[model samples]
Structure formats: C-alpha cells, structure tokens
Target: MIWNTLQLALREIRRNLLRSFLTILGIVIGVAAVITMVTLGNGATKSISDQVSSLGSNLLMVRPGQRMGPGGSAGAPMFKIADVQAIAAQVSGVKAVAPETRKSASVVVGSRNWSTVATGGTRDYFTAAGWTLSSGRIFTEAEERGGKAVCVIGSTIQRELFGGGDPLGEMMRVADFSCQVIGVLASKGQSAFGSDQDDVVIMPIRTVQRRLTGNQDVRTILVSADDGVSTDTVKARVEKLLRERRKIGENEDDNFNVLDTKQIAQALSSTTRVMTTLLGAVAAVSLLVGGIGIMNIMLVSVTERTREIGIRLAIGALEHEVLLQFLIEAVVLSSLGGLVGVALATGASLGLSSLMNIPYLFNPGINVMSFGISALIGVVFGFFPARRAARLDPIDALRHE
Candidate 1:
C-alpha cells in the first residue's frame, strides 16, 4: 500500500515537471548559499591559524608601544640590545630572544633594483622568527660581532634581483653601502595580513644600525618560549622585567605591549565563526520561503484534482491514503531539490576556494542536517493542503467543475 501510494505521488509530480522544478527553486538556492558561505568561512579560519603558526610556536612579540599601529609607540623609548640580553638571562621557560630593527630601502643588483624591507638581527632571529635558509649559511660569529656588510635575502628578493641565478656569493648595494649575499631564505609565502613574507633582506643588527638607519635603537624583540611552556606566563614575566628596567611606577601605565600569536589566532578564528553563523542564518530565510511555495502549489494541485479526489472517496479509497499521497509528493520535491543543491555547492566551494587561495573543507554533517531540514519542511507545510483535500465532502467535490 505504501509503495503504491509513493508511485502515485511520483506520477502526479511527473505530470507537472516544469511546475515542480520551479516550486523547489527556492530550496535549491537557499541550501547552496548556506553551504557555500560556511565552507568558505571554515577555509578562512584554517588559513588564519596556519599563518599565525608559521610565525613560530609559543611566540611573543614585545614592542615598545602602548598600542599597535603607525604612531602607537610615539613618545615611547626604544628598547636596546641590553633588554634582549636581560630577557634571555632572566626569563624562565625562554628558548631564544632576538633583537630586531627594520629599514625600508632600495637594493641594487647590477641593472635590477627592488624596493624592500631590510631587517637587522642576530642569528637567534632565525630561531625566534621560525626562519630557515634554503641555501648558504647565517651570519658567522665574526661577521655578527664586527657588523660586516653581509646579508641573507628572502625568496622574493632573490627572484626579483637574481632571477634563476644563484644569489650566494653575490654582492648587492643596499642604501649607501655594499653588502655580499651569504644566504637565501626559504619561502614563507604570504602572511595572514596579506603581505608578502618573502620580500625582505636580513643582515646583522649592527649592520643595519650602522649602514642604514645610523641608530642604536631596537624596534622590536621576538621571544620564543620552550616547548610545553605557557606563553602567557612568559609574556607576564617579560612585562614585569621590562617595567622594572624602564622604571615604570606601580600606578603608571605600561610603556610596552606584548602580543601572543596564539591569542591572535583564537580571536581571528572566533570572529570568522561568528560571521559564518550570521551568513548561514541569513541564507536560511529562503528555506522558509521555499516551504511556503510548496504549500501554495500543493493547494493549487488539490483544487485542480478535486474531481479525481471525489471519485476516489466515492470508490471506497480511505481519506488517509489520499493525504499520504500528497504529502509524499511534497517530500519528494523538496528532497530532490536538496540533492541538487548539494551537488551545486560542491562545485561552487571548490572553485571559490581555489580563487580565494584558501582550503576547501567539506562538512558532511551540515549537508545531512540541511537535507533533513528540507524533508521536514515538506511535512510541515504540505500537511495543511493535504488535510484540506482529505476533509472535502465527496458530494461537494464532485459537484465542483
């Protein structure tokens, strides 16, 4: 009996194929939009986490600023090599510390020149910054102590200045001084903030201070904590030590800021998730609209088949059977829409993820839940029309043309 009723429902839907397709269009669009938004959001969250992790594990960025941004550090005293030494000596659970300064300068290699950022730091900078060389070596102890004019170039700089040729053992002019290239850094690709991480030149700290900036100021200090150590603990300790070193009174506001990369990752991920939920919710409104469409069309269908329904009732067909047939038709229509929407979403997610340079993360749970919701919508909305058809008096339905 159930199979026969299902067959009758399919037959009725097949008779009005065009209308059936149009009826479910809203469901298709709603499902596709929700899935696409959520998939992209997940990908963006993963990308943020990966980019932050690339900065280094258990990392803390200590800057001489009350805030972050262009002039947030204005009127604040700059740190020195002594501060870096003090942190390395006094801070427990510390793995390495790097004192860093930066200058924007144009580098010339023969006829080719590229404007890039030049960073100055010691060998510990490599460890703290999670940098590794693709070729050659870091600064020798003598080169570091003497502030020799030698540099290591990032992948972007190497490509721009040297093309496919080897950059090692080559001399490049930076600002007013000539520096030999001792190493080429492995590519780090783009940062989370969308800047190219590989567009840089690195040299000994003293080299940048002496040849480029003509200063002894350290702009930033990077601290890497030991594995299994809490970055929060290290950050607090660094803040305390710096306060004493900078002579900030107990009631005075801090003159420095310590940023933890893990906290940054969490905050960014949470923001993306909230956005995803909002977008998904906005897209879900169309599902309710689709359900209303199903109800309206089913009402029209029952009216058009009124005479047939009356004949069935007159010939001993049960009222429940007639109702079940119409309800099944509605479910089939919605379920079909859901399947097609899933297929469309898969293609859209793949294309968009590639275009956006983010990963494509498929979520099966959402797909199943969406499909289930659509099926349930059919039952909720289709019931009113189905019940109305079942309750019609046989004599009255037959008399209606």
Candidate 2:
C-alpha cells in the first residue's frame, strides 16, 4: 500500500516538475539566508572575543579623562604622571604600571621619511602589553632616566622603513630628535577596534614628554595585576587612592577613568548576542513566508488533481494512504530544497567572507537546525492539503473534474 502511494506521488511530481520546483524555491532561499547570516554573526563574535583575550586576560587601562557632561564636554581636570606613581605604590595586587605619552611624529632615516605614531613609556610597558622583541633588547633603566633618544620600531615600521636590512642599531630621526631603533617588536596584527596595531613606534617616556609634548605629565597608564587578583577589587582600591591623593571631595566625581578590557569584552558580547537573536527572529519571518507559499501550492495541487484523487479513492486506496502520499511528496520536495540550500549557503558564506575580509565559520549545529525546521515546515503546511485530498468524495470529485 505504501509502495503504491509512493509511486503515485512520484508520478504526480514528475508530471508537474516546473510547479514543484517553483514551490520549493521559496524554502530554499529562506533556509540559506538564515544559516548564512547566523554563521557569519557567530564568526564575528568569536573573532572579537579572541582579539580581546589576546591583550592579556588581566589588563586594565587608566586614562586622563573626566566624565563627559550632557554636551560631551569635560567637567573635571585631567590626571597627571603623579597619579601613575601613586597607583603603582599604593594599590595592592598590582604587578606593574607604565605611564604613557603619545605623539604623531615624522620618522626620518637619512633621506627616507615616514610619519608614524610614537608611544613613550617605561620598560614595564613592553611586558604589560604582552610585547616581545624580535631583535636587540629593551631600554635599560639608565636610558629611561637620562631621557636617551632611543626608540623601538614595530613590525610594520620595520618592514616599511628598513626593508630587508636590520633596523636594530640603526638611527632614525623622529620629529626633531634622532633615536636609534634598539628593538623590533613582533607583529600584533590589528586590534578589535580596527586600528593597525603594528604601525606605531615605542620610545622612553621621558623622550616623548620632553621632546614632543613639552609636558611633565603622562596622558595614560597601562596596568597589569597579579594572576589571582580580581579586576574590580584593584579598580576600587586605585580609585580610592587617587581620590585621596588628588584631594577630591566625597561628592565630586572622579577625574580619571579606570577601564578593564575584560569587562568591556563581556559587555560587548552581551550586546552582540542580543543583536544576533533579534536579527535571527527577523530572518525567521522569511521562513514563515516560505511555509505559507508551500501551503498555497499544496492546496492548488489538491484542487488540480481532484479527479486523480477520486479515482484512487474508488480503488483499493484508503483515506490514510491518500493523506500519507501527499505528505510524503511535500516532505521529499522540502528536504531536497533544504539540502540544496545548505550547499548554496556554504559557498555563499565563504565567498562573502573573503570579499568582506570577515572570518568564516561553518556551524554544523545551525545547519542541522535549519534542515530540521525546513522539514517541520513541510509537515505543518502540507497537512491541510493532504487532508482535503484524502476526504474527497469520489462521485462528486469525478463528476466535477
């Protein structure tokens, strides 16, 4: 009985191949879109998390900035270099602190000149930043104390300025001061915020302060805490110490900002997860539309094949057999579409990621879910039409059509 029903379903589909294909196209496109979008979103989130983790899991940045007012204007004074020293000395669980000074300077190596960002900091900055030297060595305590004109070129600068030749021991003029490149830092690629990580150069903190900014203060500080210390605890202690040292009243807000990258990453992940769910919900509407299209086609198919259904009913076929036949046909059509959709989506995702320079991650779980949902849609939307065909009155259906 099942074999007979299967044969009939195949014959009907073969006779209306064009109509069957058109009916399946809706589901094919919908399933493909959902899988592709979700995979891409997941890959992006994973990339962001990896980048954040790369900056060391226990790092914090202290910057000189007041809380912005409604108009985005600074409401308090900036933090000074004294705050950095105070944090390093007073805060418990703190491993190291490096005060930073930044400047945009033109680097001149004989006739070759390139404009790049310069960061001035202590030797601790290298360790706190998870940086390693590819050649030469770090600045000594004497070099930093004497404010020697020495600099470390990043990998990008090393490639751009020095080419194949060794940049170490080579002197390059930054702005008005001539500094020797003592070290070449390993490449860090790009940051999560899309900044070129290797484009800048590093120098002794005093050099940038005295030579470039002409200020005795540092703009920012990078802190590394002990492995077992909690970030919030250290942040609170540092805040209290700074407030007392700076003579801030209890009612006044903080002048400096202490930011933990791990906390920022958690917040960003939460926000992106919400966005992914919302987007997935919106995309699911297309699948619903596809289901509706399948139902409409099935109903039309029942009406067009009324005589055939009547003939089958007059024979040895039972009502349940008629229903199962139509149900099987719908499942076959939708399952085929789902398989094709998966293939197309995989190719499209790879192509799009390559073009956009985004990471491509093929998620098996999402693909299986899509395929299962497609099959469910087929069963749900195909039921009504199958019932109508099964309940057909043999005499009336045969006479009318």
Candidate 3:
C-alpha cells in the first residue's frame, strides 16, 4: 500500500514541477549553508591543533617579565644569561637550555639588502626549539665565546638571497658587521596564524650583544624537559632557582615568568571547540527555515487536491492511504533537496578554503549526520499537513468548488 501511495505521490509532484522546485529551494540553500560553515570551522580547528602539537608536547618557555600576557615575552622583562646557566645546572628534568636575544637588522648579500630579524644564541638553540640544520653546521662553543662573525640562515632567508645556490661559505653583512654563512635551517613552513616561521638568521649570543645590539642581557630562554619528566615540576624548580639567584625577597613577586607551551595549546584547543559548536548552532537555524517551507507547501498541496481526496474517499480509498501518499511526497522532496545540497556544500567549502588559505578536509561523520537530519526534518514538519488531508470530510470536500 505504501509503495502504491509513493507512485501516486510522485506522479502528482511531476504534474506541478515548477511549484515543487520553488518549494524545495529553501531546503537546498539551508542545508548547503550549514554544511559549508561547519566543514570550514572543523578543518581550521584541526589544522591549528596539529601545528601546536608539532612544536613539542613537553616544552617550557621562560620569558623575562614582571607579569605575563598573551604576547609572551613582549610583556615580560629581559631575562639574563645567568638565569639560563642556572636552569641548565640546577633544574632537574631539564634536558637542554638555550638563552636567546633577538634584534632586527638589515642583511646585505653583496649589494642586495633586506631587513630581517636575527637571533643570537648557542648551538643548543636549534635543539631546544626542535629545529634542525639542513646544511653546514651550527656555531661551536669556541665561536660563541670568541664572538666569531659566523651566521646561519633560515630557509626563507636562504631562498630570498641565494635563490637555489648554496648559502654555505657565502658572506652576509648584518648591522655593519660581515659574517660567514655557515648553515641553513630546514623549512618549517608557515604557522597556523599564517606567519612564516623560517624567515630569519641566527648568530652567536656574544656576537649579537657585542657587535649588533651591544647588550649583555638576553631576552628569553627556551627549555626542553627530559623524557618522562613532568613540565610542572621543571617550571617550579626553575622559578625557585631564579628567585634565589636574583636575591628577591620571598614576599615580593619575582621578576620572571615561566610558561609551558603544552598548557597553552590545551587551553586554546578547548576554546576553539566551543567556538565551532556555536557557529554550527547558528547555521542550524537555516535548517528550521527549510522545514517550515516544506510544511507551508504541503498545506497548500492538501487544499488544492481536496476534490481529488473526496473522489478517492467516495470510491473506497482508506484514510491511512491518503496519509501515506502525502507523507511520502514530503520525504521525497526533502531527501532530493538534501542530496543536492550536500554536493553544493562540498564544492563551495573546498573552493573557499583554498582561496582563504585554510585547510579543506571533509569529515564523513558530520556529512552523514547532516543528511539524515535533513530527512528527519521533512517527516516532522510534513506530518501535520498530511494528517489534515487524511482527516478531511468527503461530503464537504465534494461540495466545495
């Protein structure tokens, strides 16, 4: 009986093709919009979490500051080289510690000049930061102490200055001081915030302080904890050591800040998840609008076919059959619109992600759930109109014009 009703429902839909198309328009747009927004949000969140995770799950950053802010060291006070040595010698579970100073200077390769940031640190700087040298080698301890004029270029700087040629053994002048390019770092690519991480040069700590910035105090410290060691424990130990060394009174706050990137990543990930859910809820409103459109059209259809209903009932048609016919029509309409919406959403999401430089990844579970929910909306909204058609009085329907 349901199969027969479906055939009749489809035939009726075919008779009013134009009206049917107009009625389904709302459903199509609503479903497509929801899908596109959700897909983009999910992809962006996943990409961010992955990048953060890659930086190391057990790394701690010590910045110089009286009070910590979101910008990390930008709000902090200047850290000292003595502090770095203290953490390295006294702190347990600390594998390696690197003190660093950053200064922006103009770099000259021959007559071509470009302004770029230069970091001054020891050979442990790359190891502590989870970076590797792609070519040549990092500065040795002798070079660091003697303030040798040697430098290493990051991948971005190498490409801009040397093109495809080897940068090793080349001479580059930074801040009126010429240095030999001894190494080039491997590419780390752009970060989640779209900033290129591989766009600077590195030099020995002594060289930068004496030759470039002329400051003895370091800016920040990068610390990597040993395997199986807790980051919290390391932070506590380091803070105690720094306080004792600096001779700060126990009552007053210490002029230093210790941050764990692992903690920051977890907090950020939780915040992003909440944001994604909120955006999805906003998009879901369009689905409700689509359902309302389906209900409105179904009601009009029942009114227009009242005489047909009356004739069928008078001939011997059952009320349940009438209900089934109308219900099937509603489901078919929504289901067809849903399939088309899914396809459109997929294409639009991919295109927008590429243009915006965001990652484009389709989640199968989300897609399937959205399609099923669309079909369910059709049934819930269509039930009222279909039931009204089924309960119509044959005598009154026949008497109407």
Candidate 4:
C-alpha cells in the first residue's frame, strides 16, 4: 500500500516536472551554501595549524618586551648572549636555545642584488627554529667562534642570487661585508601571517652584530623544549630564571614576554572555528526559507488537486492514503534537492580550496546531517497541505470548478 502511494506521488511530481524543480531550488541553494562555507572554514583552520607547526615543535619565543607587536618592546633592554646560555644551562627539558638578531640588507652577488632579511644566530638556531638545509653545510664550529664572514641562504635568496646555479662556494656581499655562501636552507613556503619564510640569509650572531647592526644585543631567543615535556612548564622555568637574571623586582612587571607557538595555533584555530559556526548559522537561514517555499507550493498543490482528491474519496480511497501520497511527494522533492546540493558543494569546495591555497576537507557527517534536515523539513511543512487534502468533503470537492 505504501509503495503504491509512493508511486502515485512520483507520477504527480513527474507530471509537473518544471514546478517540482522550481519548488526545490531553494533547498538546493541552501544546502550548497552551508556545506561550502563549513568545508572552507575547516580548511582554513587546518592551514593555520600547519603553518604554526612549521615554526617548530614545542617552540617558545622570548622577546625583551612586556607585549608583542611593533614598538611594544620599545625602551626595554635587549638580551645578551649570556641570557641564551643561561637558559640552555639552567632550564631542564630544553632541546635547544638560540639567541638571534635580524637586519634588512641588500645582498649582492656579482652584478645581481636582492633585498632580504639577514638573521644571525648559532648553529642551534637551526635546530630550535626547525630549519634544515637543502644543500651544503651549516656554520663550522671555528666559523661560529671566530665570527667568520660566512652565510647560509634561504631558498628564495638562492633562486634570486644564483639563478639555479650552485650558491655554495660563492661570495655574496651582505651590506658592507662579503660572506661566503656555505648552505642553502630548504624552503618553508610562507608563514601564517603571509610573510615569505624562505626569504632570508643566516649568519653567525657575532657576524651580524659586528657588521650589520654594530651592536652585541640579541633581539630574540627561540627555545625548543624536548619531546614529552610540557612547554608551559618550560616557559615557567625560563620566565623565573629571566626574572632573576634581569633583576626584576617582585612587585614590578617583568620586562620580557614569552610566546608559545602551540598556544598561538590553538587560539587561531578556535577563532576560525567560531567564524565557521557563525557563517554556517547564517547560511542555515536559507533552509528555513526553503522549507517555507515547500509549504507554500504544497498548499497550492492541494488546491489544484481538490477535484482529483474528491474522486479518490468517492472511489473508497482512505483519507490517510491521500495524505501519505502527498507527503511522500514533498519528501522525494526535498531529498532530491539535498543530493544535488551535496554534489555541488563538493565541487565548489575543491575549487575554492585550490584557489585559496588551503586543503579540501570533505566531512561526510555534515553532508548526511544536511540531507536529514532537508527530509525532515519536507515532513513538517508538507503535513498541513496533506491534512487539508485528506479532510476535504468528496461531494463539495467534486462540485467545485
């Protein structure tokens, strides 16, 4: 009996194919928009996490400032190499501690020159910052100790300066001094903030301080805690030691700030998720609109089929059977819309993710849930129209025009 009713519902839908398509258009658009927004949001969150992780595992950045951002550390004292050494020696669960300073300069090789940031630090800076070489070797122990005029170039610098030629054993003039290229760093693409991570040149800290900046001050300290160690614990210990070393009074706020990369990743991810939810909610408003559309069309359908309904009643067809047939028709229309919407969402997500340079994360659960909601919408909105058709008087309906 249910199968027969469903067949009748399908026949009626097929008879008005154009109207049925138009009726479910709203559902299709709503489902597509909601799924696409959510999928892209998840991709963005994943991209943020990956970029932050590229910085280092269990990483903490210590800067001599009460806060972060431009000029936030102004008037604060700069750290010395001794501070980096102290952290390495005194702090437990530490994998490596690197003292670093940076300067922007034009690096000239022969007649070709490119502007890039020059970072100065010991070999441990590579370990602490998760930098690895694509070719050549890191600074030799003697080169580091003597502050030799040697440099390691990032992939961007290598491409710009050498133009696919081997940069190792070549002399590159950095600012006023010439340094021999000893290594090329593997590409790290871009940072989370959209800065090119590969656009850099690294040298011994002493070299940068003596030649470029003309100072012995370290601008930042990067600490990499050992695996299985809590970064928060390490951060606390490092903070306590720095407070003692910098001679901060118990009542006075410390002049330095420690930033955990893990915490940064988590905060950024959480914010993205909140935005995703908000966008999904806004998109979901269309579903209600679609449901209303279904209801309006179903009511119109009942009015048009009044005479046919009366004939069914005269032929001894049950009232519930009439209701069931109309209800099934509504459900089938909405369900078809849901299926088409899912397909459209998947294609849009892939294209958008590629254009935005983020990952495509297909969530089956969301697709399934969206389809279920669309079907449920059909049941709720179709009921009123179906009930109206079932309650009509056969004699009066047959007598009407």
Candidate 5:
C-alpha cells in the first residue's frame, strides 16, 4: 500500500516537473541565504578574535585621551615618558610596559621609497604585543638607551621595499635619519577593522622622539598583565596609580583611559553574532513562503487528481493512504530543494569568503538544521491539503470530474 502511494506521488511530480521545481524554489533560496550568512558571520567573528589575541590575550593599552576604539583617541594631552616608568614601577600585576609613540614617515632605501606608519617603543613592546621576528634580532637594551638608528620592518614593508630579499642589516632612510633594519616581523595580515597590520616600521622610542616626531610626548602605553592576572585588576591598579601620580582631584574624571584588548574582542564578536542571527532570521522568512507554496500546490494537485482519488477510493483504498501519499510528495519536494540549497550555499560561501578575504567555516549543525526545517515545513504545510483530499466524497469527486 505504501509502495503504491509512493509510486503515485513520484508519478505526479514527474508529470509536472516545471511546476514542482517552481514550488520548491523558495525553499532553495531561503536555505541558501541562511547558511551563507551564518557561515560568513562565524568566520568573521573568528578572524576578529584571532587578530585581537595576536595583540596578546592579556594586553592593556593605556592612553592619555579617552579612546573611542582601538588605536583611537579624541584630542587629549600626551603621556610623558615618566608616566611609562611610573606605571611599570607602581603596577604590580604587570608583566611589562612599553611606551608607544608613532608618526607617518617616508622611508627611502636606494631607489625604493615607501611611506608607512613608523612607531617607537622599547624592546618590551615585542613581548607585550606577542610579536615574533621573522628574521634578525630584537633591539638591544643599549640600542634603545642610546637612541641608535636601528629599526624593525613588517612583512608588507619588506615585500614593498626589498621585494622578498633579505632585509637584515640593510640601511633604510627614515625621514631625516638613515636607520638599519635589524629585524623583519612575521606577517600579521589585516586587523579586524580592515587596516593593514603588516605595513609598519618600528624603532626605539627615543629614536622616533628625536627624529620622527621631534617630541617627548608619548601617544600610548602598552601594558601586558602577568599570566593568571585579570586585566580588570591591572586596569584598576593602573588607573588608581595614574590618578594619584597625575594629581587629579577626587571629584574630577580620569584624564587617562585604560583599554583591555580582550574586552574589545568580545564586544565585537558578540555584535557580529547578533547581526548574524538577525540576518539569518530575515532569510528564514523565505522558508515560510516556500511552505505556503507547497500547501498551495498540494491543494491544486488534489483538485487535478480528484478523478484518480475517486477511483482509488472506490477500489477499497483507505483514507489514510491517500493522505500519506500527498504528504510524502510534499516532503520529498522540500527535502530535494534543501539538498540543492546546501550545495549552492557551500559554493557561494566559499567564493564570497575568498573575495572578501574572510575565513570559510563549515558548520554541520546549521546545514542539518536547515535541512530538517525544510522537511518540517513540508509536513506542516502539506498536512492540511492531504486531509482535505482524504475527506473528499468519492461519489461527488468522481461525478464532478
């Protein structure tokens, strides 16, 4: 009996292939969109977390002005070098502290010249930033103390200036000073905010102060907390120490703002997930439309096959068999659409991720969920039409048809 019903359902679908395809088109589009959006969003969130973690998981950036975001600042007073020393000495939970100062400087090496962001900081910056050199060695303590004209360049700078050749011990003119490239930093790719991370040059703090910016004011102080120490604890201690040292009154707001990189990464990841959920929800509406199409087409199919249904009923066919036949047909149509949708979505996501430079994460859970939902849509929408056809009077249906 079940075999008969299945065969009849397949025959009906084959008889009107165009209509059947059109009916399932909405399901295909809905499943594809939901999967694609969710997959891409998850990848983006992961990429952001990685980039932030690369800056050191327990990192804190203390800036003189209230920063709106990472490396961002409104107009505010610059921190002096003494403040950096004070934070290192007074903050107990800190592993290391580095004074950061930066300016745009044009670098010239022979005929190849490039303009990039040049930064200055102590050798501790490497540890605090989780940076590992691709070649050569870090700045020596003597070099930093004596303000030697030695610098480290990122991978992008190396590619642009040296064309993949060895950059170690090569001399590059940075602004007014001719500096030797002591090291090349490993590729960091791009930041979560879409800025090039490997397009920078690093030098000793005093070197930048003396030649690049010609100032003693520090832009920011990069701090790394000791392992197992909470950044909030460090942040609180640094805030208190700075307030006392800067001599702000009890009633006044803090002049300096401390930022935790982990907190920023979490906030951004949470936001991306929320947006992904919202987009997935919006795309899910098409599934309902697909369900409605299934319902409508099933009703039409019942009407068209009234004569066939009457004949079956007269031949001792059970009402349940008639209902199951139509229901199964609807489910099969939707399930087929879902399978096709998954394939299309996979291709689209991979292509889009490559084009956008985001990672492609294959989430089996979402794929299974979409497929299951598509099948459920079939059952929910197909049942009404199936019941209606099963309850139709054979004599009336046969007479009318």
Candidate 6:
C-alpha cells in the first residue's frame, strides 16, 4: 500500500513537471541563502582568528592609557625606554620585550619616493612579533647602541621601492636622515582589521628618537612569554608590575592596558558569531515563506485531483492512504529542493570565499540540519491540505468534478 501511494504521488508530480518546479522554487532560494550566508560568515570569523594567532603564539601588548583603540590618551604619561628595560629585567616568564615608537615619513631612493610609516624598535621586536628576515641581517648590537642609520624593509615596501632588484646594502632616505637597508622582512600580508601589516620601515629605537620623531617616548610595548607560560598569567604580572611602578594606590585605577592576542581573537570571534546568527535568522524567514508556497500549491493539487481521489475511494482505497500520498509528495518536493540548494550553496561559497580572500569550510552539520528542517516544514504545512483532501466525501468530490 505504501509503495502504491508513493507511485501515485510520483505520477502526479511527473504529470505537472513545470508546475512542480515553480512550486519548489521558493525552497531552493531559501535554503541557498541561509547556507551561503552562514558558510561565508564562518569563514570570515576563522580568518580573523587565524590572522590574530599569526601575530604570535604567546604575546602580550602593553600601552599607556586605560583603554585601547585609535584614541590617544590625553593626560596619560607615555612610556619611556627605561620602562622597556625595567619590564625585561623584572618580569618573569618573559621571553622578550620590544619598546616601539612610530611616525609617518616619506621614503626616497633617488626619484622613487613612497610614503609609509617609520617604526623604531629593538631587534626583540621582530622576535616578539614573530617576524622573520627574508634576507640580509638584523641590526647589530653595536649599531643599536650607537643609534646607527640602518633599517629593515617589509615586503610591501621592498616591492614598491626596489621592483626586481635587491634592496640589501642600499641607502634610502627616511625623512631628513639617510639610512642603509640591512634586511628585508618576510611577508605578513594583512591584519585582521584589513590593515597592510607589511607597509612600513623599521629601524633601531634610538635612530627614530634622534633622527625622525626627536623623542624618547614609547608608544607600544610587545612582550613574548617563554614556552609553556600562560599569556593570561603574563598579562596579569605585567599589569601588577605597571600598577606598582606607576605608583597607583589600591583604589586608584592603573593608567596602562595589558592585552593578549588570544583575548583579542576571542572578543572578535564572539562578535562575529553573534552577527552570523543574526544573518542566519534573517535568511531563515524565507524558509517559512517557502513552506507557505508548498502548502498553497498542494491545496491546488488536491482540488484538481478531486475526481481521481473519488475514484480511488470508490475502488476501496483507504482515506489514510490518500492522506499519506499527498504528504509524501510534499516532503519529496521540499527535500529535492533542499538537495539542489545545497549544491548551489557549495558552489557559491567556494567562489565567494575566494573572492573575499578567506577559507572555504564545508559544514556538514548545517547541511543535514537544513535539509531536515525543510522536510519538516513540508509536513507541518502539508497536513492541512492533506487532511482536507482526505475528509472529502466520495459523492461530493465526484459530483464537483
């Protein structure tokens, strides 16, 4: 009896192929939109986390001010080079410390001039930031002590300034001072926030203090913890030490901020997950609309097949069999639409993820869940029309046709 009912349902659907396709169109679009939005949003969140992790495995950032962001501290005292030395000497579990200061400068090698940020830090800055030298060597200790006019170039600057030629041992003008390029850094494409991490010139801290900015104030400090040390533990230690060094009373708030890359990644990932949920919810509204479309079409199908239904009843077919047939048809239609939509979404996700410069992650759980929900929608909505067809009196249904 079940096989017979399924055969009848398939026959009815096959007889009106064009109409069937049109009815299921809503399901296709709805499923595709939901899957595409979720897949892309997840990829974006993963990309953010990956980039943040690439900054360093165990890293802590210390800066003046009670908060972090673009806004500078108005009354907060900037950190001095002595602070970097103190942190290095006093802090336990610390692998390295890099005190940094930066300013915007125009770089020139003869007529090929380009504008970029000029940064000054000790060699530990590279180690703390997980930077590698592509070629040449880091600034010598003697050069660092003497405040020598030497610098390293990032990948972007190397490309923009040197083209195909080697930049090693070349003299480039940074602001008013001429500096020799001693090394080139390996590529670190971009930050999670979309800033070009490689668009900079790096020199020793003293060089920038004397030549460019003419100040001993440090803007940021990068700290790398020793192996197996917890970043949170390092952050806590740094905070406690700074609070004591700054002479803040127990009740008074410390004037500096200690942040780790893991904390930043988690915060950003949480925010992104919330946004993804909202987008997915918005996309799900269409599935409800699609369910209504399936219901409406099923109602029309029952009306047109009223005569056939009467004949089936006259031939000793049970009313429940007829009900099951219609319900099955609805489920088949919705499930088929879901499968096609998943295929479409997979293609779209691959293309869009590449265009957006992120990874394409396949989520089998979402695919199965979406397909199951679509079938469930069909059952819930198809019940009304199926029941209406089943409850029709044979005489009345025959008379109407």
Q: Could you give me the TM-score of model 2 versus the true structure?
A: 0.91
Q: Specify the highest-lDDT model's number.
A: 4
For residues 1-401, what per-residue lDDT tens digits would candidate 6 score against the true structure?
Answer: 77888888888789999999988888888888789889988999999999998787798988888888766455788999888998899999999999889999999988898999999989899899888988989998888878999999998889888884799999999999899999999988889889998898989999998988888899999999999999888888888888888888999987888888899999999988998889888878998899899999999989988988888778877889889988988988888888888888899999999999989989898788888888898899888889888888998888876
Whole-model lDDT per candidate: 0.91, 0.83, 0.83, 0.93, 0.89, 0.89
The estimated TM-scores of all candidates read 0.96, 0.91, 0.91, 0.96, 0.94, 0.97
* Residue clash pairs of candidate 5: none
lDDT comparing candidate 3 with the true structure? 0.83
The number of the candidate with the highest TM-score is 6
Model 3 regions more than 4 Å off: 54-57, 69-77, 398-401
lDDT (10s digit) by residue, model 5, range 128-161 = 8777899998899999999999999999999999
Residue range 1-401, candidate 2, lDDT tens digits: 77877787788788899998998888888888888778767766777777776675678887655642233325445556777788888899988888888889999887777889999999988877778888888899999988899988888888778874798899898998789999988877777777788888899988998999888877667888888999888888887887897788999877777888897788777776777677777767887788888889999998988988888888857889999999878877787778888898899889887776668998999899988988888899999999998998988878765
Q: On residues 1-401, what C-alpha lDDT tens digit does candidate 4 reach at each position?
A: 99999899999999999999999998898898889999999999999899999998999999998999899799899999999999999999999999999999999998899999999999999999999999999998899989999999999998898997899999999998999999999998888888999999999999999999999999999999999999999999999999999999999998999999998999999999999999999879998798899999999988988999999999998999999988998999888888888998999999999999999999988899888988998999989999999999999989767
Cα deviation at 43, candidate 4, in Å, is 1.4
> How many clashing residue pairs, candidate 5?
0
TM-score of model 6 (CA atoms): 0.97
Question: Candidate 6, 30: how far from true, in Å?
Answer: 1.5
TM-score of 4: 0.96
Q: What is the lDDT of candidate 2?
A: 0.83
Which lDDT tens digits does candidate 3 get at residues 29-69?
87788888888887777777766665655778777666566
The predicted structure with the larger lDDT, 4 or 6, is 4
Error of 6 at 182 (Å): 1.6
RMSD of each: 1.6, 2.6, 2.5, 1.6, 2.1, 1.4
Instruction: Give the distance in Å from residue 96's predicted Cα in candidate 5 to where it truly belongs.
Output: 1.5
Runs of candidate 4 with Cα error greater than 4 angstroms are none
After superposing candidate 5, which stretches have Cα over 4 Å from the reference?
1-4, 69-75
- The 10 consecutive residues of candidate 3 with the worst lDDT sum are 68-77
Itemize residue pairs with steric clashes in candidate 2: none
